[model samples]
Target: MNKKSLSQQIYEARWCYLFVLPCSILTGMFVLYPIGMSWYFSLLDWSGFTKDAKFIGLQNYAEAINDPFFWNAFSRSFIFMFGTVPVKIILGFVIAVFLNNQVLKLSPFFRTIIFMPVVTAIAIIGIVMTFIFSPFNGPANKFLMATNLTSGPIDFLGNPDTVLPTVMGVYVWKWLGITMMYWLAALQTVPQDVYDAAKIDGAQGYRLWIHIILPIVLPFAIVIILVEAVSALNVFPLIETMTAGGPFFSSEVMEVYIFRTAFVTDAGTMPRLGYACAAGVFWGVAVLFITALQGFWMRRTRRI
Candidate 1:
């Protein structure tokens, strides 16, 4: 049979194209349009409020490069990603292993309990966590004091030294359930027969896990870690609600930095929309590079 012409193929799949039209339109409007606009705005000198925007070429980007606060925010984002991703992966895998045990009772209930936070609104969790970790009369400090863990209340969200780590901890706790679910799914891919055969051969417990189960689930673990690493960079809402990048901008990630530059202007200074867009474009490229790296690694792992 002859291959169909492009026009003929289009005619045959007209209904499929029709079905995809709405999503394509929405994506163009929301995703593509904004991306294009961001790049265009990055080359301009616009305050976002004024109708007139002067084209300044790459000055905004150059300014961003020299800006110390921009570098600080960028470093903080990576720190958060590095801090949370490993803890989430290891802890999530451990919890998933425990829950995946066939002899364990009420595993489903425990899974639901753990996963509840994943579905909870970040804003709500942030608010509740802020209150819980409040420096004065907060439940956490109260407990610590009660147990004599510390003689004085610790400002978990207030101190610059502690804020980022405290935020990282909350982020891991909030998203741990999803990572656990990923591990649980990976665990399910191991056949019962494989486990039984391993048992028959006297391979059990840590030996069975390290030798057999780990090899089987290694790919999934890698993918999960990469995905979570990307996710760990996006904690704007939680940080905003809990600390608002407070105590002298200690917790300002890229997202918060962009928002502050684009919208939050101090007295006598206009909102630097163009500069913010430049920063955003830079950060977006970095994230895109990371995502591409993830794809490359995943492909290599699949080949192996």
Candidate 2:
């Protein structure tokens, strides 16, 4: 016989609010606070740790627009995306097909072996890769020398011409298992009757995959592309530990660039927290833009 006010309704649901309050508070503290602080910092000239955050208005953004190195790093992020994403998607899909094969016994064991690298530490992977690609006595070099491919070690990761591609190869190798799992999960969702019908229609092997399976898994492929695209832009630790963005910054990506600008400047130079925050903000906006484009394209494709 009575209507409750919004406050009264909330009061009645206090326990539900209490249940979600911790998560909300944590999100505000970690996510929202950092974003707000970063945006504020982007407008100031401060060393990240110091209290002297002098407001500089939009000077940081202005500097970023003219900064050649920043633009180079931005371009390199896209290069890294292009170098890794397609290869990983194609190779992962192929591996998923092999693993999903009905005749393949011990598929689980192979899958476990392949996926081990996904759980491995990037630092460890980089270190191991460094040793493996070492010119002196690395296994790869040894194999090459033994096979008479060259007179000596090729310096795969040490050469500027090769380092980015080498890093891409290692990145693809480490993450392929996870991508394979995504594809495999998508593949498993396809109906058995669909395969039966395809087989009855004389579609076999590659034809069945191309005609039927691919259409079914296109959505999963889009998800994988979006995920890997964002991730590939943020590549740092692998490039850090493996190459240190060196061979003269040939492998420097957005994250590595942000870190170097923020904290790892020349010996006498103070950290440019504001400038780095601007760079970070720019990267965040760029990623959001790219992801938005991906979402739009996916929606458009579905409409078609």
The CA lDDT of each predicted structure is 0.94, 0.90
Output the TM-score of candidate 1.
Answer: 0.98
Pick the TM-score winner.
1
- Residues 210-302 of candidate 1 have per-residue lDDT tens digits of 999999999998899888988998889999899988889999999999999999878999999999999999999999998899889999998
Among these predicted structures, which one has the highest lDDT?
A: 1
Off by over 4 Å in 2: 1-5
Worst 10 residues of 2 by lDDT: 228-237
lDDT of 1 at 212: 91
For model 2, residues 1-304, the per-residue Cα lDDT tens digits are: 6999999999999999999999999999999999888888999989988887899999999999899889988998899999899998899988998899878899999999999999999889999999999988999999989999889679898788999899999999998898999999999999999999999999997899889988998887788888888888867888889988888888888889999999898888899999999999999989999999999998887776
Candidate 2 at residue 136, lDDT?
82
What value does the lDDT take at residue 153 in candidate 2? Answer: 79
